[model samples]
Target: QLDAVPSFRMAVHPHIGTRSLDLVSERDKVGFETVLTSAKLMIQEKLSVGSISAHLADKYNLFNNSVKKQREDLLGQISSVESGKAATSQSSKCSHVVGHQAACCIKFGSNIQFRASTPEERESVPPPISKERGLVVREETCDALLALLTGLKGDTCKTLCLETARNEMKNAGDDNSLICDLTLLSFVRHCVEMGAVALH
Candidate 1:
């Protein structure tokens, strides 16, 4: 199971914070290029005929039974690797509070915001990621993007994807909102063009 994600990557300690992943390397020139490329990969790697067929075959299984299985397999694959890293660290501090509702979120200063969720909402509070107004790719997108971006694999990439998505949504504005909508449509068009998906 995925742990509740605390928003923000800023660290009182080094290499930790609510949204610290937004910060980048000395070798990289652009602020978001490293991240955006990863984001693109997140969407692309899943752009296979199977995934596309899966999306179309079952009338959009983006948040179906398969996702739960995917989550389980992904989490299992990465936990061992992450636990190992945490063990090596002098602090050994890589566990979330047991019952906290975890989410991928965007953090601004001390504030953290949840990203989007596949399942629709019943609660009053907004999910870190928006539903109608925004374009949420998928867990596949998250998995792929994080793998490409942080050079982290297994569950670590999952966390990285959630964190990055949170940051991406957090940065959204009116203009950005329009861009997201266009991006979603563009994604559909691109999927058809790339022969990764077929149009209805």
Candidate 2:
């Protein structure tokens, strides 16, 4: 199961936050190149009708499980290997490697965010004015997007996608409203193209 987890090399980007896995490395890069290639291919696979969301959800669960198993296995291996070595010398080496590896795994297993270091830095970042337009605007926008994406005509599907995105934006105090309609449309189109959402 641990081997089943897709392996992709990641590095922190200097600007525009962390890039997607596709932008991280070339196909010929070292370390688990085959795994990375297979992952990219799997992501490119087309989804059948009514299977897009389910397929992604299942993959998410699988990846989540795999990461958990990997962590457990890594720790177990560290423990077993250290048991036979000198306590003082092996302790420092194992701890350093394990700490670095564990940190890398945790970071890669989740979304990456760029945070401001100080109040001045925070102030330099622009606020989202559109979010202040009120929950009604969010609800309406989510309803419209949900209706277009799914055959369902109400708030039922709103919570599934659009609303959740809005809530996260709201919590982060980021105004996505200033984002141009064309860009937002492109995002939705990309989501559909990537099988993250399905249209009926």
Candidate 3:
């Protein structure tokens, strides 16, 4: 059984307020990267599907157990508060005084707004490497082109084959999303050329 470490719990619940959910803390990043690395190793070693299934089951069980513990703790707190209120009401009745119901709602701040940071604020953190930035741009462009060529046929299929060939040549060095997308597009184009109808 996997233990529920604080870092993993933080990964499970990263958001604290109205922060961008897409942005994760360094701890969450570490946890996710660890899991991803393990999964990659499992794939490379040709591990059985049941091995991966069991790994996923453990993670899910951790999440479910954490949620259950939180629910039980919350209910216990509510019960204690209600009992305290009932005792207060009883004492108030003996003294012929009115008892007030205590509000037990939890409040969260909603005043935060999202915005791009100023250059000065961004200066603290170093920018991504040029190669990394280039890779991201290339990946986005390839994804857009793939979306356009999703349902290619006839003249469109030929045009996409040419485009995919060009992209594959340009992206041959890097094994990134663009290369994957181009490969998929090339496969689809070949299938269409081979009299296979593109459905949807």
Candidate 4:
């Protein structure tokens, strides 16, 4: 791509009168002028080429760095968006679990209220304390039920169980055959109290 170096040429100065000058001396003088002109042109051409090359290199480097920075900025934005999505997904899942737990707690409390209306209705159910073993079965049962609700994993099963319990209580009417024992009522009361405090 480079321009070829100009060939050296010999010529006599127009100002020098060839009529008065010696032919041999004129030829020598022309040869010297040719060499000087060739050397100056060559030096100028080399400097021009070097300057052009340096300018192109600087431009290319600036463009390359700009592209690299843009790519990094794009990747960083993608990472931030993905991280935000992950956090939102986790928050939604927690909210769903808390919602389920709150529903179960409310349902359990409602069932307790429906069962334990009067003093006689409460007293009719036998005490959970086993006289011989000293084991409180009602407390254990309430604890197990609370654990199930807290887990929030068995929605359909819990709903079915609650429905069955409510039906049984309804059928018992004024009889003492209802399963809303005193220990479960106490557990429900405790949960309501705790929930109230948390809200405050």
Candidate 5:
């Protein structure tokens, strides 16, 4: 209801004092002084608000500048790291070329097939999950959970799967089915490797 009302304020008008003493009464002088003091107070209030606003703006600018600096610093660090990685990769490729040339120079009986190292191969390596100290759910259990999660959103499935795995681990005390030692992430990785769940 209050919102419906127009926000209107009456303008302040300072009393004008007459220069002629004969025309000015004591009451008129008092009224003029009262209005003058009120006007001064209003001006002071406005100045106070302006000062506060300026102070707040300064603080905000300082904070914003700090955030920008931090972001720039982070981006710079990331670019340097990326450049370093690129240099390392280039060097490795050059070394590989040199090795290949040297191999060609050698009159080897037959061309030997060399397995190249890759990030995918490294990531696909399974963790050492043992029965004594690791949290491992049964493969069947994982498959079942994953089957239930089909058609669900990726994030929702991931979260739900993690939560379900945790619950299974907690409830799998003395159970022979869930006897392997694995962390939550390792369990998920295992599932991913087994094609039970697709990695996002």
Candidate 6:
């Protein structure tokens, strides 16, 4: 965005006005003022603040658009990280197990553990889920966000959540077999990245 407009930058931090441009005169004494624009009648005489303001607006608008596009793209990416077409080798269900999905995707708070039909089923994934404290959705959301930061997506952990959810149904002994390992967190991460957020 700053590629044009002479040597101007679209975003001049407030600190720049206070620190770098501090102890300065009203005019372009150190070129800091030129970082954006000088006075109304300083540049080329023909240059108008209206033109500069319009140019800056366009650049900022473009930046915002780019950010928005990226967010949508990320949402789509995370949405399909676990492709519906990419099914497991065995289209199986947790026998005599039950599954329940989270209220929503972000995992903002509340660490919930899905119970099992029998104490044995809980150990299938090792270290059976014992009744414990719940984490707020925000904590889980932060963890999910941090997941994208690392080389590995927090998907495995997300997988565990889904597994636990489905496994809880097994604990109930419903045998519906509607278990899926997709975490809405993955999708939410995509949403945040692409900037198509809920604004909530």
Q: Candidate 1 vs candidate 5: which has greater lDDT?
A: 5
- Estimate, for each residue in 112-183, the C-alpha lDDT of model 6 and write its tens digit: 222112223323322215663322233323443333223122222332333344453456454333121233
Where does candidate 6 stray beyond 4 Å?
Answer: 1-44, 74-200
> Lowest summed-lDDT stretch of 10 residues in model 4?
108-117
User: In angstroms, how far off is 126's CA in candidate 3?
Assistant: 31
Q: Would you estimate the TM-scores of all the predictions?
A: 0.20, 0.19, 0.19, 0.18, 0.20, 0.20
Relative to the true structure, candidate 5 reaches a TM of 0.20
Model 2's TM-score against the true structure: 0.19
- Candidate 5, which segments miss by more than 4 Å at Cα? 1-44, 47-53, 67-69, 81-155, 158-200
Candidate 1, overall lDDT? 0.33
Between candidates 3 and 6, which one is better according to lDDT?
3
Q: Rate the local accuracy (lDDT) of all candidates.
A: 0.33, 0.38, 0.38, 0.40, 0.40, 0.38
| Cα lDDT of model 2 by residue, 76-174, tens digit | 543443332343343233321111221222211122111112233323333434552212223424544443434322232332233344344556555
Residue-level lDDT of model 3, residues 107-171, one tens digit each, is 01111111122234324333334443211223434654444334332233233233344464455
Residues 19-119, model 4: lDDT tens digits: 55555466766776677777787667676867889988888678657666644554454344435345345334332121123223322212212121223
Two-way TM-score contest, 1 vs 2, winner: 1
Stretches off by above 4 angstroms in model 1 are 1-58, 61-63, 83-162, 173-200
Alpha-carbon deviation at 1 in model 3, angstroms: 17
Clashes of 6: 23
Clashes of 2: 1
Specify the poorest-scoring 10-residue window by lDDT in model 5: 105-114
Deviation from native of the Cα of residue 63 in model 6, angstroms: 0.9
Clashing pairs in model 5, backbone N/Cα/C closer than 3 A:
134-180, 134-181, 134-182, 135-181, 135-182
lDDT at 4 for candidate 5?
31
